[model samples]
Each structure stands twice: as C-alpha cells, then as structure tokens.
Target chain A: MEFSSKVLEKAVNEISQLPGIGKRTALRLVLHLLKQPKEQTVFLSQALLTMREEIKFCLNCHNLSDVTICEICSNKNRDHKIICVVEDVRDVMAIENTGQYRGVYHVLGGKISPIDGVGPNQLNINSLVKKVKSGAVSEVIFALSSTMEGDTTNFYIYKQIQESSIITSTIARGIAVGDELEYADEVTLGRSILQRIPFENAFKNY
Target chain B: MEFSSKVLEKAVNEISQLPGIGKRTALRLVLHLLKQPKEQTVFLSQALLTMREEIKFCLNCHNLSDVTICEICSNKNRDHKIICVVEDVRDVMAIENTGQYRGVYHVLGGKISPIDGVGPNQLNINSLVKKVKSGAVSEVIFALSSTMEGDTTNFYIYKQIQESSIITSTIARGIAVGDELEYADEVTLGRSILQRIPFENAFKNY
Candidate 1:
C-alpha cells in the first residue's frame, strides 16, 4: 500500500514489523496515534526503549528480571528445592497465573528445536544441571509443552541429572477438566483412558 | 496478569493502550521484542517518534502530507476542477488504489456525528464550500461511507454549494460486482433495481 507521507510510510513499516500485525493494521494504528495527543507517542516510544535497554535476565531461572534474580526465584515462600522447568518466561508467567504451583522456575529459554537451529547447548540446560547436581533440589518438574521439541528437551535434561538422585516428573496431559468426552480428540481421549487416575486422586483440592 | 519485571510491565501497559491490543497480546509482543536484537526496538521507537513529531496535514485537502499541499492536490495531471470529497486520507488512499478516478480529493477529516459530539464545524466542510465558491470546480463527488452521518454531511455540503453551478453527486450504492443475487440483502438489491443503470453503460469498464 502507498502512503501519502514518507513519515507515515516509515512508521507503518516499523510497526508492521511486529508479529501478527499487518501493514493495513499498522497504518490504522499509526493514524490513530496521529489523532491523539503527541505526548502519547513519546510515552509509548520511551516505554519500549526503556524496556529493551534496561531489561535483564534472572541469573538463576533465565526469566526476565529487573535484578540478577527474578522475584519468584528469590522469594522465600517459593520452594526453591522443587524447580519447575519451562521453555521461557512466558511459560513461567502462565504457570504462575494458575496459583497452583509454589515451586521456583528454571526457564530453558527455548525447547530443543533443530529446525530453528536451537539445541541443548543454546539453552540454559547447564545451569539447571548444576543446580540439580548441587543437591539443594529434591524434585524437578517439567512444565514444557506437549510437543516433540519439549519432550526432547525434557529427556535431555532428565538424563543429565538422573545420577544426582533428583525426583524428575512432568505435568500430566489429558482432555481439559470441563470439556465433554464426546467432543474430545481421539488421541487425547485414548491417552486419558490409558492413563486414568484413581477416583480419589482427581479431587485433591476440590 | 503480573509481570516479573517492572520494565516489562510498563512496556506491556503502554503497548496495550493501542486499539485492539490486550494485556496478554502486549506481553507477547514485548517478549518477542526481548528475544530479538535490541536495535529493532530502538529503530521501531525512533520511526514512530519521528513520524509523530514531523508529520503535517495538507493545507488544501487536509490529507496527510510532508508538504503544504498533498501530491494529489498539486499534481497538474489530476483534474483539480473535479474534487472527490472523502472522510479522511484513508478513504483517499482506498479510492486511489482502484486506479479509476483522476480527480483530486477534499478530506472532511470526519463525518457529522452529533452523538459523538462531532458536528459539521468539527470537519473540513467550510474549506470545501470556499473551494467550490471560487468557481474553479465543476463537480464534487461525495465518496463518504453510506452511513446516516455520511449522508447528512453530504447533504449539508450540497446545500452550502447549491447556489453555485457545481454538480454534486454521491457514489452509486448497489450489490457489489461478482456478488451472487441469491445472497444479496433486500435493501441493497431493491435499491440496485430502483437505481438501475443503462445496460450498455454497465459494460463500459468491463
């Protein structure tokens, strides 16, 4: 799409570079900014720049942090002995939102995706192994996605710390709690049946 | 949702202020930026700031431009005597994309919407009337949306220039080209029948 103004064209190009945003959507957003107060643009730009310039990674979990260690990893109430492994800070935030898990996190930065040229060496695997081998951890929970890359990363980390006597586990995968069984996909339904739990175990908190 | 870092939280808040973006989506975009090279964020911010600070509106047409008069209004090849009145620069761009019209444009900035506290005075209506009164224009095409507000604005402008000999007309409303008759809405289909054009004229641009 052609723009009447060079500045508008440049702004649209930059805004559309973001994921899930198209040129048309960027144009609409830029035009909206033009209609608002000039200070709004300054605030937005400054916020983005400040975040990118000063953001730091947690020393222990590899999650985003303002300091060396993130809040969850540094909190005394969180069970540091029980580390919940995740792909990135996004997963850590998602799990934290549930409020069910009280354990600290070990963010891997990413899963083992060879197609993307991401391997075990490219992740925070070594730091996690060192943490487990230190014998300060009792249990290691894998909260990675249920994809091939997640499984591979989980197994790779499990093998590295297996000799350290850490109780390794993964979050359970099945149909959603409130979903109807009739509408469940065949693979998930079959897996749920094969891995059925004890009747009493399903009502742990409820 | 809580963010681990203050900078991340601030960035997410600012980004989510844009239309159609939510806190979760903003967090996702911010995290994606974190994963990229820091220069990308700097570039994006700079482009937006420059556009907002240096952008100008064309004096004659009120369309976005880097100069006093926009490219369309200044172009000698375009028929300046035949002005197409539109809602905003977006409409001008949309019409230009069709490559069908050679006339210049007059951007109204917005239509008359009393409920939204927007009246004719809030638009670029007077400049349009003044341009017509100069006796340089022969025809004025009303290319605004087919909404009630659009029609009201068109009628108001037409009344203002009625004393002059300038021909005032609105875009044709009917079922769209290539649309199936069976699925056509009653209002549009009925209007198309009532405003039926000459059979040979329909084939002019086919």
Candidate 2:
C-alpha cells in the first residue's frame, strides 16, 4: 500500500513480518494503533523490548523463564523424576494449563525437521540427556506433535536415553475429547482404538 | 494462561489488546518472537517507537503523513477541483490501487456513528467544509462504504454543502464485476437495475 507517512509504512512492514499477518492486516493494526492514544504504542514497544531483553530460558528445563531456573523445575512439590518433553514453551504452557501433570518439563525448543535445517544438536537434547544421565529423572514422557518430525524427535531422544533403565513413553494420540468419532481422521481413530485403555482408567476424571 | 516470565505475560497482555488477537494467539506470537533471533524483536520495537514518535497527520487532509501536506494533495497531476471523500486512508490506498482515479482525497477520519459515540464534530468535517467554502472544489463525490454509518455521514456532509452550487454525487452501488445475477441480493440487484447506466458507459474500461 502507498502510505503517505514513511514511519507508518515502516511500522506496517515490521508488523507484517510476523507469522500469519499479511500487509492488509498489518495496515489494519497500525491504523487501529493510530486511532488510539499515542501512549498505547509506547506501552506496546516498551513491553516488547522489556520481554526481549529480560526473558531467559530455564537453565535446567530450557523453558522460557524470568530467572535462571523456572518455577515448575524449582518447585519441590512437583515431581522432578518425571520429565515431560515438549517441542516449545507454548507446548509447556498448554500442558501446564491441563493441571493434570505434576512433572517438570524439558523443552526441546523444536522438532527434528531436516527440511527446516533444525537438527538434534540445535535443540536442548543434550541438556535433557544430561538431566536423565544424572540418574535423577525416572521417566521421560514425549509430548511432541503427531507429525513425522515429532515422531522422529521422540525416537531420537528415546535412543539417546535407551541405555539407561529410565522408562520412556510418548503422549497418547487420539481424537480430541470433545470431538465426534465420525469426523476423526482414520489414522488417529485407528490408533485411538489400538491404544484404548480400560473403561475405568479412561473416565477417571468423571 | 500461566506464564513463567513476567515480561512475556506483559507482552502478551499488550498484544492481546489488539482487535481479533486473543491470549492464545498472543502467546503464540510472543513465543515465535522468542524463538527467532533477538534482533527481530529489536527491529520490531524500534520500528513501532520510531513510527509513533515521528508520524504526523497532514494538516489539510487529516490523513497520516510525515509532513503538513500529503503527497497526493500536492501532486499537480491529480484534479484539485474534484475531491473524493473517503472514511480513512485505507480507502484512499484502495482507490489508488485501481489506478483509475485522478482526483485528490478528503479523509473523513471516521464515519459518524452515534452508537459508537462518534459524532460529526468529532470527525474532520469542519476542515472539509472550510475547503468546500473556499469555492475551488467543483464536485464532491462520496465514496464511503454502503453501511448505515457511511450513508449517514455522507448525507450529513451533503446537507452541509447543499447550500453551495457545487455538484454532489455518490459512488454507485451495484453487483460486483464478477458477480452472478442469479445469486445477487435483492436490494443491490434492484438498485443496480434502477440506476443502470448506458451499456457503453458500463463497459468503458473494457
């Protein structure tokens, strides 16, 4: 778009660089910002800068934290022996929201995607191995996506820790709890059937 | 959602305040930024701040600009006598993209919507009237949206300028270029048929 203000154009360009946001969306956002008080922009900019500068990854779990070690990893009430492996901080957040798991997380940062040039070395696999090799972690649960990359990363991590006696498992794959079985994809439906637990164990929450 | 980092929470809060962005989406955006090199955040922050600090509105048109007068209004190639009244700068950009118009623009800033607490006085109507009263403009075309608010604003402006001898017109409302007449809405189809232009005028661009 032909923006009369160079600054507006620059701001739109910067905003559009984000994933899923296009030039039209960026323009809408910038125009919305312009409509509001100038202080909103100041606050937004400050918040982003502050987050960028101060945010740190947990030294132990590799999850995003404000300090050297995250609260989940540092809390004694949580089970440190069970390490739930996730692809990113967002996954950690998602699992945390369930309020089901008591285990601390090991954030791999991303899956093993060869096409994207992301290898095992690029992720926090070594740190996780170090944690497991310390003999403190009893079980390592793989909670990555169901995609091929996710399975590859899970297998890669499982192989690295297979020598140890620590029990390794992956999160269950199935149709979502609220979804209709008829609409479920064939692969997931088949897997869900094969991995079906006893009726009592499945409805423990109820 | 529970956040390990305070800065991340704050950034998410600010981002989620924008229209259509929810907390989950905001978290996704924040995490994406975290995954990328820190320089991207710096660039985004710098662009927002620079734009907010340096941006100015054109004094004459009330459109966002770097200077007192916008480039469009100052361009000698555009017809200064014919002004296309629009709701905002995006509309101006949309019309400009067609590469058909040669007239300058008068940005109303926003449509008059009592429901949203926007009144005629709150907009740039006074400046538009001042421009019209100067007696240079020969035609004032209302190119606002077909919404009630847009129509009200156009009518209000039309009434304000009715005392003057200058001709006033509104852009046509009709079936879109590629629309099928069978599926067209009654209101628009009826209006298109009632205000049907000569066959030659309809295909002038062809």
Candidate 3:
C-alpha cells in the first residue's frame, strides 16, 4: 500500500474511501487513469464535481433530478394519484423499465434500518404520509424489496396513512417470470400459492 | 439503466469507464457519493486531477515518482550495479515490501503482448538495454511474472544484454511458503523439487 508519490497516494486514498473499493482496486483504477489520455481524467473529475454540486432532488417524489420536480412526477398524463412507493431512484428506474406501471413514484430514499441509524424521519416518509392524508391520492403501492427493513418501512407508512380512504397494497411476491416453481424460495412459493389469481386472469395479459 | 438526471448519468458513464466497473456498480458508487458531504466528492475529484496532471516517472527506471530521480534510484546505499527488472510500479512496491533486496529496479512498464499491441518498443526495454550496455550494472535480475508475455519480454531483454559481461538471473519459480504439498500444482511442485537448495540454506534467514 506504500505509494511512491504523495499525489498518487492521495488519489488512491480518496478512491478507496468509496464503498466496496479497496486500496488494491483504487491503485489499479488510478494506474488505469494514468495510462489513459489526460482528458479522460479531466472529464471524470469534472463530471463528478458538476453532478455533486448541481444535482437536484425532485420536490414531489425525492428522486434525483435536474429540475425542481422530476419528469415522472410532473407528467400530466401519468396517474400521480396512484403513487408507487420505492426505496430509491434505482427502484424508480427499475419499475419504469418494466413499462407496466403508469403511476407516479414516491422515492423513500432508503428503508428504516435501526442498525444503520436510518429511521422513518430520515427518509421521505413524512411527506408521503402528508400526501396520502391530503386525499388527493387514490392508491399507494409499496414496491420496496421484501427484506426486513423494507417490510418495516412499509408497515410504518401503512400505519401512518391507514385512516386514509385510499387503497393500500404491496407488490405481489411470487416466483420470477422465467424462474422454475421448484427453485423459488419457500416463503415466496407459499405466498404465490396463497395469493394465486384466477386461472382466466393469468391469461388476460397474454 | 435509464437515468433521470443527465448529470448523474454523465458521472456514472465516466466512473464506469474504469476497469472492472459496470453500470450498476457505477450507479451505486455515484449514489453513495451523492449521500456523502459535498467536500468528499470535491476532494476525490481534485485528488484524481492533481495525480493525473502532476505525477512524474523516474528518469532512470520509469517508475512513478514526484521527481525526475525516484527515491530508490537516488539512494546511494542501494546497489546500482544490480538491477531488478519488473513489469511495473506494483512489482517494485511488492519487492520493496519484502525489504530483502538491496538492488534498485528498472520498471519495464508492461510485458510484450502482441494481442494488446504492446511491443518491446512500447516499453522501457530500450532504456534498460542501454543501461546494461553502459557496463555499470554487474547483475540483471528478471522479476517479471511467469506468463508467456513475461517470458518473452525476459528472453528478449536477456538476448539484448547477453554480450555484456554481466550475470543474468530470474526469480525462482516454486511453491509458495505456506502452500500445502497435496494441493500444489504439478508443475510448481516439480519445479520446487528440482530447484531445491541445500536443506541448511532454508534456515539462513531465521
């Protein structure tokens, strides 16, 4: 880990500060940057600085955006009244990729994890509760992953807006489209069986 | 893979250009950066730019340095007459960590790989040959890895300096210190047996 140059050492230290990257990986990356054209480093550095300084969060959904409100939240044709709650912008992108959901998203930023010192207050939970209580929303879909933290956050939000008249639901947990039934975990298999849709309804999308 | 923010996308693209990083990992890293304080991103960007712009290579050995003459080359205590030829600065650092060798190093920059468009001309081989021809160095140790390209680079350099009145050697190839005999590869185990030194010599360091 001993660097011959102070500048190289400083760069490696900064790069290794990132999650999942170690000193060896940082050294390899820095050496690669050294071998590439100087413009590559310039562009990388400039892009990172500009993004960090100028990036904005959507006022409505809390997703990353270049404007005050994100495109999804601002689209008039989309069903903003039917909000799909997610953990972060990545989930927003994932759900958008599916092209199955036309509703707006309310990015929670992260889950309620006590061990990580992250609670409901630190996320966008309060705003979501307020929005639901305002009676403008007709349905709120909890689309976070099925981990303990995701379930905890979902329950917390459900309790907050339970008195509201809007429908509250979670995305169905089932075996993935291409996955074999036998390969599905026990909990997912059991839940899929318990929540089985009508035989004719399965062919409706097809 | 679609990004809601152009700035975030640009930064992810730049970061993903590094070896071993993919778009998903890049997004994770960028999102992590966004969660951190602005100074963290600023410092990382500044450090990368400064390192790329200001880093220097040693005049004699081509190893990375802040000055024309690296500390190893400038030190009078090390034996300048014995040069350890290595693939890059990483090898130099590895050997330096061992603290067993007293000789200075001549970094080859990289091995000769025709598939990668890397030839001896692209490396520091010419300077090493010229240094050897000067008759100041009495022994040249080949410390490059034992890959095909490494062997080719070694033999090529050996042929260049063969006529000079200097001894040439390569680092030993054998089983690692703590490796179990049963799990050792045949070639490595055979070589270890063939190149075994006197039994008493193994305890010399102790």
Give the top-scoring candidate (lDDT). Answer: 3
Q: Which CAPRI quality tier does the interface of model 1 achieve?
A: high
Give the alpha carbon lDDT tens digit for every residue of B1-206 in model 3.
88999999999999999999999999999999999999999999999999999999999999999999999999999999999999998999999998889999999899999999999899999999999998899999999999899999999999999999999999989989888999999988999999999988976761
All candidates: CA RMSD (Å): 2.1, 1.9, 1.1
TM-score of chain B of each: 0.95, 0.97, 0.98
The local distance difference test score of each candidate is 0.91, 0.90, 0.94
For candidate 3 chain B, the 10 contiguous residues with the lowest summed lDDT are B197-206
Worst 10 residues of 3 chain A by lDDT: A197-206
lDDT of model 2 at position A23:
91
Q: Which lDDT tens digits does candidate 2 get at residues A1-206?
A: 78878898999999999999999998899888888998999999999989989999889998889999899989999988999999988888889888899989999999999999999999999989998999998999989997899999989988889999999988888899899999999999999999999988986861
User: lDDT of candidate 3?
Assistant: 0.94
User: How good is the docking of model 3, by CAPRI class?
Assistant: high
- Model 3 spans > 4 angstroms off: none
In candidate 2, the second chain superimposes onto the true chain B with a TM-score of 0.97
Computed on C-alphas against the true complex, the DockQ of each candidate is: 0.82, 0.79, 0.92
TM-score each candidate: 0.93, 0.95, 0.99
Candidate 1 residues A1-206, lDDT tens each?
87899999999999999999999899989988988899999999999999999999999889999999888888999888999999877788788888899889988889999999998898999999999988999999999998899889999998899999878888888999899999999988999899999999998972
Q: Is candidate 1 or candidate 3 better by TM-score?
A: 3
Question: For model 2, which pairs clash?
Answer: none
